[model samples]
Target: MARPIWSGILSFGLVSVPVSLYAATEDHTVHFRQIQRGTSDRVRNLRVNERTGKEVAFGDIVKGFETAEGEYVVVEPEELDQISPGRSKTIEISGFVDLDQVEPIFFDKTYYLGPKGKEYAKVYTLLQKALEQSNRAGIALFSMRGKEYLTAVRADRGILTAHTMHFADEVRDPHREIGNLPESGTTVSDRELTMAEQLIDMLAVDWNPDDYKDTFEEKVHELIAAKQAGQEFEAPSAAPRPSNVIDLMDVLSRSLESAGRPAGADADAGGGSEAGAEDEGAGKPRKRASAGRKKAPAEDLSELTKAELYRRASELDIPHRSTMTRDELQAALEQAAVPARHLRAAS
Candidate 1:
């Protein structure tokens, strides 16, 4: 069994249940150490005194809170702990609210709550069942590790889960930060809206998180393995971002057709019968189906401008493209445009 990070009483109304909090998630990201380029010597960080220009011991460190008057109030760890919200070992539930009422942006970390002892299991189960039936979460204030937090306690699969949430004032208004948002009163044509819905229906699939994997992480591991084997390899080229669509209706029509669905189909009708299983690579714009017109022949590299050539190079996933000259880009594109079968036979 995993050890609990905190032990506290969950109090609401007249009932109090003793519970223990355990972290619900763990980090699995790959970590690297800083080192000199040519030498095996690892880089190390040190805490040094600015005036003395000497390294400081961990025990000698003190906390300082900067004041508005440009002065720091130097404080010891013990002094701060004395005034901390440490004495309150209770998660006091202030209100109950629908789970949907809470925005996901406000949530931070998640932890699992379990009954401290077998005796408290009944009350714990009672709260869990009540919250599950009501589709509501308990908003509470909890103090842990010398700090107080706003938290939401919700039931998940018969277990109590607590999520730390940002205070109302801590969340910034998006409207204040962003500019030129679409007007709320702006209207969409019924025809365009119906076609967009049909396109969406053609692309919709059941949510299965297991179907996705971090490809970048997988590539990093591959690179590490190749380096360990003393094999020379070039880094994969980055995919270019698609340009903004100038023709929304044309794009939507192509999307529906590519998904094997008829454009402007009734929203009430089921999706395309010929539609393949949705994958990560699905729904991308294909060159062959642009506006239901036949694909034009590849442009003459000698006739195209530098910017046009750069755009084509980007589309072809050329490496070191930002540094490539116009002629070099054209040559690279021509080399890449060679038939795959011919290249394979030559190899």
Candidate 2:
């Protein structure tokens, strides 16, 4: 049996059940040690001072938070521990929430929660059954490795499982982080959409994890075995090419055909439309399904990330982009694009 990593009382309303937390998952990836090139000498890392060329003791190091370039606020481990939430011994359930209400992205590492002793088994089983039948997860908190984690506990296979979760601030805003995402109003032809749906329907299957295997990991093991035996490892076949604007429809049609669904009238409808060829690559004017829809005057600067705006500022030879905030970057980017828009209008 696996050893428990933590033992605590799981608080449920006025009732408390003694439980043990064990890791629910294990990594199977291969690990390797560092070695110097052209020799069998094992390489090791040590804490050495760059300025003094002397080794620094672990106790001498302090946490640094950078507020600006080459600037940091020094912090101590005890200071952080003083502010950390939850106690080390107890995994306390604060409340219960509908499981579906919690987004999948928020959930992180999983741990199994078992009754600490057979005497507490009744309470554990009762809580497990309640959670399962009600389809709710218990929101909990516990400290581990000097940090408190927000967690969700749900019943799984007659046992309770807790998953560490990201706070709301940790989940990034896509509009702020990502670039070049399609606008909500972007349109596609009905024929293309219908064919895509049909293809999905043809390929849909019940998810059975046993049906899949990590082929790359398998090949890695094969390579190591072959090299150990002094034999050449055979390479796998080349992967399929990526689809582009010109070949997208053809690729989709062929994919349907390969799945035993022939491309009939509905699939071929609007096959020659100019909308399919628009925006073949960047800097080209994109077209819409409706030919009458005019292009927007300029790119939505708000949609671009700060780094993208900084890159644009660099390209346009704009000043002081390094010190600018996201809003300032957007404003500068908007100002820089004005001349080009005017020149295009004049032409």
Q: How many residue pairs clash in each candidate at the backbone level?
A: 0, 0
- Candidate 2 backbone collisions, by pair: none
Report, for every candidate in turn, its global Cα lDDT versus the true structure: 0.72, 0.74
Deviation of model 1 at 147, angstroms: 2.4
With candidate 2 superimposed using the best TM-score fit, by how many Å does residue 119's alpha carbon deviate from the native? 0.7
Question: What is candidate 1's TM-score against the reference?
Answer: 0.70
Instruction: Compare the candidates by TM-score and give the number of the best one.
Output: 1
lDDT of 1 by residue, 82-125 (tens): 76453358898989999988899999999999999999989999
Q: What is the lDDT of residue 295 in candidate 2?
A: 24
Candidate 1: which stretches are off by over 4 Å? 68-70, 78-88, 185-188, 232-237, 262-347
Clashing pairs in 1: none
